[model samples]
Each structure stands twice: as C-alpha cells, then as structure tokens.
Target: MNRTTRHLGHRARPVLGRSGVALCRIGWLALALAVPSARADDWLTGAPLARQLASPVDVAWSGSPLRPSLERLARAQRVAILLDRRVDPDRPIELRLLDAPLADVFEELAAREGLGVTLCDGVVYVGPPETARKLRTLSALKTEEARGLPAAVSRKALARAAMRWEDFATP
Candidate 1:
C-alpha cells in the first residue's frame, strides 16, 4: 500500500478490527447527510434574482412622474434591478423592486391602469399608462394609511399597500 493507505490501514486496525468500526460508519453517515443539507441551503440563499423571479405574482412595478420606487425595493430585498428604456422611449425607465408587498402593489396598480406588465424570471416591466396610475394611487394611499398603523406594522403594511398595485397590474 502507498504511504497514505498504509497509514490508514494501521489506523483502521485498532478501530475497524474492534467495535470502533461502528463509530467510523456513523461518522461517514453523518457527513453524508450534512453535505446535502449544506448544498440545499447554499442554493436557497445564493440568488435573490432567481428567488424573485420564481413567483411572478410576488412582484410589481409602478411608474409615475415621480420615479418608480425600484431603488427602494431593491434595497429592501437586496437584489439587482435591471432597467431597460429602449422598450418605451416616451417613458424610458428601469428599476428593481426588492420588497414583495411593494412589488405586489405596483403590479396591482399597473394592471388597473392598463399598463403592459410582464414578469420574465425576475425582471418587471411597467408599461406607460399603468406606470402613471401606480404613482397616483400609491401617493394617495400612503397619505391615508400613514396615520392609522402602528410604527412597525405601519412600515411593513405601507410597503405592502404600496405593492398592492401589483395585483392590479397586467400579468
């Protein structure tokens, strides 16, 4: 046997020859189970974009004279927002929404406004008309909900409320 195998053989004598073999088998089994779990978690947390895109219903966008809150959502969810302006020159825009609620609201509003909303993987598109309506409705709702919610709930709820537009936006 080579040096490494010889060393292992020597070590195995005391362990494998005796009841210690049981310990070795248990160690290997434990390691095997641990390896797959680690791999699964890695995949789960690795890509924000993939996670976002998996559920198109989970995101939305709103456009207005005021810039869409793509940046805000991106910061919240820690994902990159890819913007493309070539599709609509009159209202060229691109942004990423990280917050699910905000995305939902944007989607809803976009639908109501008749904007062409499409979710391809993780990318969100807000057509002109729907984009405008999203801004208007959010602006109005934000003001109304501001006073009624508790501090923490208010923040999360407002974000979700803002995203309620996602439900309205075109699929």
Candidate 2:
C-alpha cells in the first residue's frame, strides 16, 4: 500500500506544520520582547543627566565669557560640561532667557558660536561640528566593542580611570 506517512520524517514532514508555525511565532515574540524599541528622545527620557539637562533654567548673560558661563551652569546643574580646547573659552556671548532648558541653551550657544554640542558619557561636549557629530557614534561603538569582551575586561574598559603624570615613564 502507498499511504502518505508524515510520521516517517525526512521528506514526509511539511515545511511549516503546526509545531513549526507555533515555534516561529514564539521566536518572533521573544525577539520583540528581548530587544527594546527606542525612540529619538529615548536619551532624554532614559538618562538622569539628560533629564536634568532638560530642566528649565533662567539664564542672563551680558557679554559673559563662554568658559565661566558654562562652568557656572555646570556647577548649578551638577552636570559635567567640557568645552573643547580648540574653541575659544574667553569668547564673549550675550544671552537672556526667562526659562529655558539647558539643552536648548547649549543649542543656541553653539549656533551663535558656530560650534556643535553633544552629550556623551554623562558629559556635555561643546566642540567642532565634526567632532560633535561623531561623538555619539564613537561612544556607541566603544560600548558595543566593550560588550564583546569578558566581564572584567568590559568593566575596566568602561570605567573612567584617572592616571597621574607619574604613571608614565620618560622615553
């Protein structure tokens, strides 16, 4: 007798039978849940520093030096702000805002100075346009690279270790 036997396995099994379909659906669901969905404003929402940067502040600067103004703001907000060496710290800037978020203030300042601003590693970096544009991408790449290493190595890579001048020997 020539009866079709699905239990025989090999060519007898269907490509996507009940079990296969169920497994595929479960796999897709697991994948969806495993990887988080992100939005453009995720950084502002997720990071505490980012959220702090979004808090409103009343700024009044009348021909104030860039560096001192930024330092004051950083001190007040308790957030790290790094102004690139290339940018002129003593450059005078005039700004007045009743109540504006720090991020918007940074954007306006950058625009006026023809510079770029970016937040990386819980610090706001103000620098050349190209550097600002690449900072986030560079940070992401570093994080991704670290994730592939062993736990101890990854922790060391991520840690912000400060070195003194004595750590290096004269060549």
Candidate 3:
C-alpha cells in the first residue's frame, strides 16, 4: 500500500476491548446526531436574513496581515471565507455576501483571475468568502463563469492572495 494509505489503515484499526468498542460506537452515534447533516435545503435557505447582514463598523483586511479583522467580522456577519485549499474537493464552499449583489462581480473577478465561480440560490462562492469581495473589485477581474470547481490550486494560493490584499489596503 502507499504510504498515505498505510498510515490511514494503521490509524483506522483501534486497539480496543469489546466494551471499549461498544463505547466508541455509542460515542460516534451521539456525535452523528449532534452534528446536523448538510442537506440541499440547508444550502438553499442559508443563514436567516437577520444573520446575513454585515455591520460597517467591522474592520476590513487587505490580506493575511489583516486576518484578525476578518475573523472578527465573521463573528457578527455570520459569513466566513473558506480558501480553496482548506475546503474538501467534494464539498462546495459556503459564501455569504452583504450589501452587494454578487452575480456580475463574481463573474468578472473570476474571469480576470482565471478562477472559477459558482452561484447556487442567492450565494456566490468563489475560492473563499474572505477574499471574494476584494477579488471582485480588482481591475484585473475579467469575465467569471458559473462553472464546476476550478482546477485544484494549492492552499498557499489563498494565503498569498490574502497577504496581497493586506499589502494593497490603504492604511
């Protein structure tokens, strides 16, 4: 087996007595129930409208240097950006935009950067919500597409973009 598979296989088999196994199974079941499963409906409905609004008092970051500001904003905005690398290839990233309609902005941004954009229901998701707005405003933004996931890029791609944004932001 490959190194990764071998490692996973080793980790999957836990050394537990019968009672331990039973307890583990019970714990897993409890967790399964506690964590709500994602459904198509959840994606469509999104967070409530009351939760969707953003406060102007929130600080805006240009990039990684300003991640603290973004994190603070997310607490109130109920929005967060998931960088492409941080997301599972199988799952769509969640995006919440406030104060602006995202359709055209997303399309233009993706095209300019040759990134991918997808819109489902009212949400516009690009790489991640954190950088999506800034990206859309870039003059370099071109035409965007509602295509399937873009080519897999590195996790560092997001860090780089965020840092760039911070650097460009006016003090």
Worst lDDT window (10 residues) for model 1? 7-16
Local distance difference test, each candidate = 0.34, 0.55, 0.29
Candidate 3: which pairs clash?
62-165, 62-166, 63-162, 63-166, 64-162, 81-129, 81-130, 107-144, 111-143, 112-142
**Candidate 1: tens digits of C-alpha lDDT, residues 1-171:** 532122111112111121222222222222222222221112122255445433343433334321234434444454333223322323423334454443454445444544544332122434454443232233334434543557776554333110111212342
lDDT of 2 by residue, 1-171 (tens): 111111110121122222322322222222212222321122222257656766788889899998778867766666556677678878898888768777778877877789887665444667798977655455555566665668997666555432222212351
Ranked candidates (lDDT, high to low)? 2, 1, 3
- Candidate 1's C-alpha runs over 4 A off are 1-68, 82-103, 128-171
Off by over 4 Å in 2: 1-46, 162-171
Best by TM-score: 2
Q: What is the lDDT of residue 54 in candidate 1?
A: 39
